[model samples]
Target: MEEIYAKFVSQKISKTRWRPVPSGSLQPAETFATGSWDNEENRVLLWSTGDLGNLDSDGGFEGDHQLLCGIRHHGDVMDLQFFDQERIVAASSTGCVTVFLHHPNNQTLSVSQQWTTAHFHTGPGSPSCSTAPCTGVVCNSPEIVTVGEDGRINLFRVDHKEAVRTIGLVTECHSTVWIDIPTSSTL
Candidate 1:
């Protein structure tokens, strides 16, 4: 039987993602990233489970839940998807999308580029009394796509700092998963 275990974290968890082990790399898929929300010190953390069974003499789950990195972010992380081993796209409640680059050697992650207010509560980059949450995000290499609660779909390119195109008035979208199947827009 598989044994189930749990770890107590300090904040509300919003998203968790597995760090992809690149092809032919002599590494195991045991490290992952966790994004937290609604805390004064909201942060994204990297964790590892490879040392679960490799405990120290004290038997306290030594080095198993070790924190690789904890970086502060602007708002509640709603979604995150890794394009590769080193890059990730994250959507937030602030209606923003960010591109992060992870440095495995130093166990650090940094925001490389950001599209601020990709979807507004009112409209594209528009001001409102409150901000709408970005519902989801997906990245296929150079192309990063995001959906938001304001009924907007934003398309971004890696080389570009802003979204190149947007589809709006989507009637309060909660999520969007990009599939390679052929299709056309209904709007």
Candidate 2:
């Protein structure tokens, strides 16, 4: 039989990703990340489903998912992706991108790097700058790519504070972005 568990978080969840497990490892994925949207205060959170091996009399796992740690996020959390086992990358509606580091020793999350105003829009004859919402983010370890409502794509390195490259799609806007990594070469 299958089992299902649900939790009522006050805010609407925007994204969720399971922490990647290493190959040849006997351990299963016990943790995941979550991002929230349309709330007074948005957040990026880590949760643990507890030990799945510990089953109760009904053959269901004991306990619900527990919040491990969380951090406040600027604007709505538009997109979220796990960079690796210990790092999470998040794109926000405020046109900013952030990388959060998870410390297992303390069970805490912290901002490791951020790019402010990574995407923006300017109106004709308007002196003020408006921030564009970063709609999606994808990660390939050190490289992260983000797409925004302003029809712009930005490529960033996790260790750097500035974007490595930017591509503007003048006539189009995007809501999601993805990455494809080549595993082998064809002769």
Candidate 3:
């Protein structure tokens, strides 16, 4: 027989991803991350499913998924992706992108970098700007790509505070992918 477990988190979950287990390791995935949306205050949270292989007196899994750590998010968590074992990248509805670093030793999460108002819209003759929702994000080690409702795509390097490049005027850019060519160009 197979077993299943569930938890009732107060906020609606928008996205979730399992932490990648190191290669050649004997353990199953024990950690995961979650992003919440439509709440008074949004957040990115880490959870741990303790000892799946351990059985209780009743022959059930040992413990439920326990909260490891969490941090407040500026807007609705539009998308979430694990940049690496210790880093998490989140896109926001406020047109901001943030990278969070997880400290396993202390069980803490901290803001590593952030790009505020990375996406926005401006009318042809208007001097004011409106922020657009960043709908999606993808990561390739130190490089991250974000797409927004403003039809803009931005490429960022984790160590830099500013965007490396921006591709504007795309139509409904909800997601993106990196393509490497033989000639040393990425599309």
Candidate 4:
């Protein structure tokens, strides 16, 4: 991480605009989807750091293009993970999972695809189908595994007609994965 100061100089106002400005310093891990892990708060602080230099002095960040399509939840993001580097998933405390796909025009950026309720608490012992927040998510091949606060694991199928193809209870186990591999036999 680099420690630098940001200062603005005005042409008309000389001494008035020439005050010492502190840009502070940013930590190494505070980049991209990575957020701050404050030991004092115990809970992680998530932030979407927009590009600074890209913004004009007129206070307008929008130029000829916008990368983010939409923001689903304004609340604190519980966790984040990437899938195949083409999509970004942000799980919120409201039991909603926001999936962002790579912008079709620009493969380098992302745009929100959808925000749906994750059924982390919608099964056998669940009270009113009110879901719990997703603590973590893992993707491997055609399957996505999401672990929630209610001690349940939801399995999702990627290339299927239905998005969430299965729902089951998990006990005394960590997680599961589905892999695809082809084999060839020659004579």
Candidate 5:
């Protein structure tokens, strides 16, 4: 077993996802993206974790272990996952889910898509069902699944950010998965 540790910031970390390498790339899979939370401003960053334990305690890595790119987010990031090698999906506290694309040649990251008001919590006194926080999201190519604190789970397709299906009236749901609930039609 091997342990690798890299330090980037003091803010609370929300998620980290490694970039997937294609079959015939000359470069190995060494780049990763990270999301941070609980600070005055939230941020997402791309970093390269070079050799383990290469820093000399001066907050600097001797080699390529460093931050590559960063972007400011509207709110704290709750969760993040890679939609593909070049893209990432992030769930935010502002009730938004955003998609980002990474360009290696120019080393840039850009928001490619977003679903505003995907999930939200209107505080303790909102009668609307839309007042629930989004908890998690999962991507399976043509499908993207999301769960919310209001006990709602939504399914979306890649081409459309809007949900194709929504399961509501759920409460305090933190996470969810896609499962085959038997239908009478199948019987």
Candidate 6:
């Protein structure tokens, strides 16, 4: 037989206070243009690409060359794809997907459109992650294909937010993408 002893100890420690972004930034392009995971001020940061831009650390929309905005998604962004070099498609772990357009001239990132009703699942029975119903998405021109852990494949068309058809399930769908290949004759 073995005996075990348990004890508890308490200690106090001091942590240093740090800040984000230097006191003053000059270069406009140095700003960020993607989603963020910081102190909740902004889920996204859009930097400038031109001359001195006016931006409020509190999110003030000022110039046309300001950082592009991100979609106000309900979940963490897992994958982001830009379509036609103008629209941004973001996939989240919560099975929610969104599309955003570039408002370059607006001087602020704005949501041109979104498709929150589209729920890509990772499992069966209501698109939950535990089931892995729909886990990933891929786009090829006019089409977007989604894969899930539920052994199912769902297809949709661009500009049209509704699912065109549901291809039978294909398990363990982590991600997908389209590759352009020439036909044998063309090759």
- The C-alpha TM-scores of every prediction are 0.83, 0.86, 0.86, 0.46, 0.76, 0.51
The TM-score between candidate 5 and the true structure equals 0.76
Candidate 6 lDDT by residue in tens digits, 1-187: 7633222212111111111233254422233335432222324333443333455566643443443444354455545554444555555545555555666676444564454545444434653434232345666667766654445566777667577887664444544433333252152
RMSD of 5: 6.8
Instruction: Give the winner by lDDT: 3 or 6.
Output: 3
After TM-score superposition, the amount by which residue 172's alpha carbon in candidate 3 deviates from its true location, in angstroms, is 6.2
Which structure among the candidates has the greatest TM-score?
A: 2
Clashing pairs in 3: none
Between the candidate structures 3 and 6, which one is better when assessed by TM-score?
A: 3
Residue 34, candidate 3: Cα error in Å is: 0.3
Candidate 4 residue-wise lDDT, 1-187, digit = tens:
8634332311111000011112342432222333112222212112233444455767655231222332323334555555544455555555555555545353334344433566346556767677666666655645666666655666665444334644555654533222222232122
Per residue, candidate 2 scores C-alpha lDDT tens digits across 46-114 of 999886557789886775688999999999998898898999999999999999999989999999999
Q: After best superposition, candidate 3 residue 89: deviation in angstroms?
A: 0.4
Order of candidate numbers by lDDT, starting with the best: 3, 2, 1, 5, 6, 4
Candidate 2 residue 86 C-alpha distance from true site, Å: 0.9
List, residue by residue over 4-30, the lDDT tens digit for candidate 5: 555648768888877766756777678
How far residue 129's Cα lies from its native spot in candidate 6, in Å, is 11
Sorted on TM-score, best first, the list reads: 2, 3, 1, 5, 6, 4
Going through the candidates in the order shown, the clash numbers are: 0, 0, 0, 0, 2, 19
lDDT (Cα) of model 2 = 0.86
What is model 3's C-alpha RMSD?
4.7
Show where candidate 3 strays beyond 4 Å. Answer: 53-60, 125-127, 172-187
Task: Return the lDDT, model 5, position 69.
Answer: 82
Clashing residue pairs in candidate 2, if any?
none
